[model samples]
Target: MEPWPFDTITPEEIDALTDEEKQGLDAAVAAYIGECLRRRGVDPAPPTSTPA
Candidate 1:
């Protein structure tokens, strides 16, 4: 897989989220990035996602 371009995330998404939802989304994003780094040289994380 490739690195995600977080720097290019759209302003539309910023506007779409409520303040509380945005806080949770930000936490989820940080977790995802940490997960990506941890898997960088090892087997990929399984795709059985914990859904919203």
Candidate 2:
């Protein structure tokens, strides 16, 4: 799956996502980046984010 460009995202686009949709999107993004790092033999700590 192709990742969406961060710069292309807007608040309206994010607001349109349902809570479930948001969670799924977040998980997919994490998986994609994690796999990329794994393929390169790099293991990093999981991410931490503050609540908005």
Candidate 3:
């Protein structure tokens, strides 16, 4: 969690994003979290089991 932490963002907030913005946000957040987890020697969380 750097620029935008998960606890600070909500599903409703993401739903407010346009499709293109949403995709970019998703990538940025995923990468940020992945780095954080790696630094902690932990695995990143798996993706959603089903599409929203």
Best by lDDT: 2
| Model 2 misplacement above 4 A | 1-5, 49-52
TM-score of each prediction: 0.53, 0.70, 0.59
Over 4 Å off, model 1:
1-9, 41-52
Relative to the true structure, how large is the alpha-carbon lDDT of every model? 0.72, 0.82, 0.80
**Order by lDDT, highest first:** 2, 3, 1
Per-residue lDDT tens digits for candidate 1, residues 1-52, read 7665668787688769998888788778868876887778655455465445
Local accuracy of candidate 3 as per-residue lDDT tens digits, 1-52:
4555468778789889898897787788788989999999998779876234
Could you report the Cα RMSD, in angstroms, for every candidate shown?
A: 9.6, 5.7, 5.8
Clashes of each: 0, 0, 0
**Which consecutive 10 residues in model 3 have the weakest lDDT in total?**
1-10
Question: Whole-model lDDT for model 3 versus the true structure?
Answer: 0.80
